[model samples]
Target chain A: MNANSKTENRALASTVLELDVNNHAGVMSHVVGMFSRRAYNVEGIVCMPVGYEKNGLKSSGETSSEISRIWLLVNEDARLEQMIKQIEKLEDVLSLRRHGAEHEVFERLEEFFH
Target chain B: MAANSISNQKEMFMTSKRSEILTGAQIVVRLLERQGVRLLSGIPGGAILPIYDALSQSTQIHHVLARHEQGAGFIAQGIARASGEVAVCMASSGPGATNLLTAIADAKLDSIPLVAITGQVPKSMIGTDAFQEVDTYGLTIPITKHNFLVGSAEELLEVIPHAFRLAASGRPGPVLVDIPKDVQNQSIEVSDWPAPGASDPAPAPDAVLISRAAAMINGAARPILYLGGGVVHSGASGSAVALAEKAGLPSVMTLMALGAMPVDHPLSLGMLGMHGARCTNLALDECDLLIAVGARFDDRATGKVAAFCSQAKIIHIDIDPSELDKIKTAHVGIAGDVKAVLGQLVPQVEAILRKPWLARVADLKATHPLRMPGIDDPRMPYGLIRAVADCLDDEATISTDVGQHQMWVAQAYPLRRPRQWLTSGGLGTMGFGLPAAIGAALAEPQRTVVCFTGDGSILMNVQEFATAAEEVANVKVVLMNNASLGLVFQQQTMFYGERIFASKFRGMPDFIKVAEGFGWQTLDLDNAGDPSSALRAALSLPGPVLIHASIDRHEQVLPMVAPGAANKDMIGG
Candidate 1:
C-alpha cells in the first residue's frame, strides 16, 4: 500500500454515514465532491436506488426511481461536524444518519475487496 | 342568453390556459417573467441561441447584451447587491459558461443572490468534445448554492423556479441551471404552473438562545457589534443600528458591510480587520463581548483567527446554521434571520449607557484614528475619493475595482445607507466595478452610479464601456491611474524585499483615449486646472463619462495588518 493507504489504516476510528438523496445524474457528484473538495477521504461508498416512493406514494415514472440511499465510510475526525453541516446544506441530501464504526455494511464487503 | 354564453366561454378559456404546450426556452422565459424578472444580462452564442431567440420575443423582460460573459455575470451581481433581490445572468456553453464562473464564485463567497443560466451542448453530444461544449453543471456545482441539469423540457418548469428559490433562500448564494440545447428546443405540455419561488420563512430563533444572548448583551461591560455582508443580505441594517444605539454598543463593519451603520454615527467604528482603522482594530481588541450578527468571522475581518477577539465571548447569529461555529466557536450561537432575532432580542435586553466603554473607545478614536495623508488634495487617492464624495450625496452609489483604490474608498468614504456601496469583497475581482456600476444604473435609473477603478484593474473588463454608452447609463468611471498593480507592489515592498517582478506595467494605455474610442465622454484631471471642478463637471454629465486622475504608484493602503498577523499589530497608515 502507498503512504496514503497507510495513513488511512492508522485512522482506525471510522464512521458510516447513511444519506438519503434525490436520484439524479448529478446527485452523486454533489455528494462525493463535498468530501473530495475538503480533502476528506471516503474509505468506501455504496449507492443504490431505494424506490420512487415519496410521501408514501409511488412516483409514476417508467424511467427510474426518484430517490436513492448512499452509504459512505469515512474516518472520524474533528472536522466531521463541519463536514456534515456542509453536506446537509446541499439541495439533494434529504437526510443523514451517522453509524458507529462497528456497523457491518462495510465489514461484509471487506472480504470481497481482499 | 348571449351574456351567459360569453361568461361560460370565459370560464372555459381560463381552465384551458392552465395547461398549454411550451418549448423549454419559452417556459424558462415565462417562469422568469412570473418570478418578476424585468431585466437580465447576457451575451448570445451558438449553444444559447434557442434561448436567446425565445427571449427576443419577451415583452415583459428586457435583455442587456454585455460585451463579455464575465461582464454579464457581474452585471447580474450588481443588480442583486444593489437591490437585495435575486438577479439572473445567462451565457452560452464552454467559454461563455467558463467566463461566468468567476462572478458566480464571487457571488457564492459574498452570499449574493444570483441565478446563472447557461446553455449546454445537446444531451447526446455531451462528453464528446463538441463545438462550444462544456460540462457547465459540473463546473458550477462547487461554486453555487445549488445547481440543476435539466434532462427534459418538462424539467424546466421545476428547475427554473427552484433556481430562483435557492438563490434567494436563507444564506442566499448563486444557483446555476444548465439547460441542454435539445432541452431548450424540446416542446412539452405544462399542466400546473408552480408558484413563483420565494425565500422560505427563516427558522424561528430559539427562544432560549435568544434570551441567553440578550442576557449576555445586557451583562457585558464592553460589547461590540460586528456586522458583515449578511446584515445587508438580511435587510437588517436598521435593526442592527437600532441594537447598537439602544445598547450603546460600538459597532464595526466588515468590508462587505460598509454602510450597515453610517460611518459618521457616534458608535460606528468604521471597518475592522486588515487595513482597518487603528481605532477600530484597537476597540475590537479590547471588546469583552463580540456580538457577531450575520457576520462570518472572515479572515480579512478577523486577522489571525486564534488571536481575533481572544478576550471576547462570541454571540454569533446567522441565518445559516453551518456558519455559527465554523470559525470561532460562539458562546451563544443563534441560527435565525438576523432581522427577526434582533426584533425579539432587542426588547428583552436592558438598555444601559455603557459610559466607561464608550469613553475608552472615544479615546482610542481620538488617539489612533484613521490617517489620510493627503485628504485635501484632489490628486491624492484619499483626497480623490473625498472630492468625489463631496460632489455626490448618499443617493449616488459607489463601487470600486479591487486593489489599493478599493481599500482607500472603504477607509475614507462616508457611506450612510445600506445598498449604497458595492465592491468585490470576497473574491476581490479586478474588473467588477464598471459593469457592476452599469447594472446598478440600469436597475435604478434615477441614481447616479460612480465606479472607482485603478489603472491595472480597469483593463480587465474595459470592454463594458461600449455597453454603458449604448445603454446611456448614468455612470462616471473615476480612473485612478498608478501604472502598476498597487496592492502587489505594496506587498512586495513590505515583505518580498522590494523585488518587484510583473506588478509594474511597461507600457500604459491612455485610458482617456480608450474611453473616447468606446463612445464615452472623457475628462482628463491631469490636464484640468481645477481637478475638483473637472470631477464635478464630468459627474454631472447625463451619459457614460470617464474622469481620469494620475496617482503615485508607491502610495499604499495602510494601517496594514500583515497576512496572518494579529489585528493589534499594524504598520503605517
Candidate 2:
C-alpha cells in the first residue's frame, strides 16, 4: 500500500489502451463499464475518424463514415491482454492490440514551450 | 435513393406521429428520447412549457426539476463527472441558457461530458425580436466544446448523437443543442442511428522517444515531475510513482493533478501554482528538468508564463496536439497520455539516474525546508486540514471553492492521484466548490468526496446544501469560515491600496444554523485545532455532513511570485 495505491501496502499500476473500432455505434460503454466495474483507472482517451465510406453518400467524410479510431492512456498492470480481448469482443470493435505496456514516454520541452 | 423522392419522404415524415399539430416542446422531447437520453436536469420556465409537457408524457426518460437552471446544469455535470456519460440539462430560452453559461464554462474548462438542451424562438420570429429568444448558440460557441441550433426536427437525430459523441469523445467537454419552437413540434423518423461505434483508444507511448526523455532526466541532476490533470485521466499514478521513486525525483502536481500520487509520499509536493505549497514552489524554482504529463501549462498554473520554469528542461507528455507549446516553453515534449508515456519511460530511466542532481536536490530540500506544525497546531485550519488528510483515503475525491480556504487546502492537503481532487482551478469560481462536490459525489457514488470551501464561497450556491441532503451523496463539507470574504480581504490587503473596499463582509450568516436547516449534520469549529473528531463524526454520520471552521482573517496563500516575476521571486511566509 503505497501513495499510488488506495492504502499503504499496494502500489497503483498504469497501462496504455488502444481503441480499435470501425463505426460510431460501437459498444464503447461495454468496455468502459467493464473497466469501471473492475475498478480500473483511466488516464486519457483520444479518438479520430480515419476512413471514409466507399459509397461516398456523405459529404467530406468527417463524422466516421468508414472507421473510428481512439487512443487510451490507462492505469497499468491492469491485465491489459484480458482487457483488450474483452474490448475486441464488443460489437463494433474490429481489433485490439497492446503495443507499449513495457515502454516509457519521452518528449521535448522546447516543443511544448511557445 | 432518389433525391426528390427522399426529400418528399422526409417532408412527409416531419408532419407528426398521428398527423396532428404538436407544440414545440413535444417535438423536442421526442427528438431527445430518440437520441437515447435517459434523464435531464432543469427547471420549468415560461417559454419552454411545450417541451415540459412533452417530457411529462415520455415515460422512457426522467427529468429532475431543479430550483434553478444553474443547479440543473450543475446536476447534469455531476452525472457526467461521476458516470463518464453525457448528461443532459435544459432550461427555457433566454435567461435559461444564460444561467447555464457558468456551468458550461465549468464543464468546458474541466472537460466534463455534458449536453445542454435549450429552447429558442420560432424560425419566423427569430432576429425579428420574438419573446424568450436569445442567441444561445452565439453566446455559447466560444465557451462550449461544440454547439448546434436546430430550426427543424429533421435535423434532430442527426444532431443529437453527434452532440453526445462530441461531448464524450476526444478530450471530453460540454455541447449545447438548442431547438427552436417550430422545430420541436415537427417529427421525422430517422431511419438509421449513426453507428460509428466507440473505438478503442491508443494506449501506447512513443517508444522511440523514451530513451531520449530518460537521457534528459539522467543528464539533469535536479528534476521535478510536474504532474498535470492528464496523469489522473491517464490513470498513470502508479507509473508516476514508479518513475519518481526509481529516479528519486521530487514531484509537484497542478490543481488537476492533485491526486496523481499519494499525499504522504516522501517526495510528494501537494499542489503547485498561485495557492500552491511553498515547498513545491521552492522545488520548481530549483529543479533543472521538469517531466510534465497530461498537464497543460495553464496561465493560472504558470502564473506569468514567460518566467515560469524558464530554465527547466521540460519533457511534456500529452494527448491533445493543440495544447503543445500553448503556454510555457518545453525542451522535450511528447503528445500522448501520461500513463502510456510513463509506462514506456519508466524502464528506460532506470539505468540513467543523475546521482549528482539527486544529491543536489536532497541538499536543497535539507537547506530550505518546509515547516509543518502538528495537527493540533494553533494554526487551527492548518491542523484540522492535516488531520482530515490523515483520516481520509489517499484516493478520496476532494473539491474546493475559490477563496483563501481553497488556497489553504491546496497548500495543506495531500492529493494522491489525479481526478481525485476537483476544483474551480482555471475560472476560480466561488460557488463552484459545493455544487462540484455534489456532482463528483453523484458521478462516483462508491467513492467519498471532501469539499473544502470558504464561508463566502459556500454562500454563493447555498441552495446546494439542500441538494446534498436530497441526493444522499457521500459528501463531507468543510466550511473554512473566517467571518469575512477572507481572500478578498487578503487581496485588498496585498494588491489593493488596503482601503478595504467591500472586502469586510458584515452580518455574516451562522453557517451551522444554515447547514442544519438543509438537513445536514452540522459541526461548529471556532478553532478546530485537530479536525479528526469532526472528520470522524462527519464520516460516521448517516447522510451528508458540514463542518464550519474559522481561520486567520489576514492569511495569505504564501510562497508567491507575483505575476510575470521569475519563479525564484517567491513570497515565503
DockQ of each: 0.50, 0.02
Model 1 CAPRI quality: medium
How many Å off is the CA of B557 in candidate 2?
2.1
Q: Across residues A1-114, which tens digit of lDDT does each residue of candidate 1 receive?
A: 999988877677899999988887888999899999989899999999898675321222336777899999999888899999999998898889999988999999999999
Clashing residue pairs in candidate 1, if any?
none
Compute the interface RMSD for candidate 2: 15.4
Q: Taking candidate 2, what TM-score does its chain B reach relative to the real chain B?
A: 0.86
Badly placed stretches (over 4 Å) of model 1 are: A1-10, A55-62, B1-18
**Which tens-of-lDDT digit does each residue in B132-220 have in candidate 2?**
77988777765676677775665565567667777766566788888777777665544444443132375466677777898988777
Q: Give model 1 RMSD, 1 decimal.
A: 2.7
**lDDT values of the candidates?**
0.92, 0.70
List candidate 2 segments past 4 Å from native.
A1-114, B1-40, B46-62, B196-211, B352-354, B372-374, B377-379, B527-535
Please give the range of 10 consecutive residues that has the lowest summed lDDT in model 2 chain B: B191-200
Q: Which candidate leads in lDDT?
A: 1
| The 10-residue segment with the lowest total lDDT in model 1 chain A | A54-63
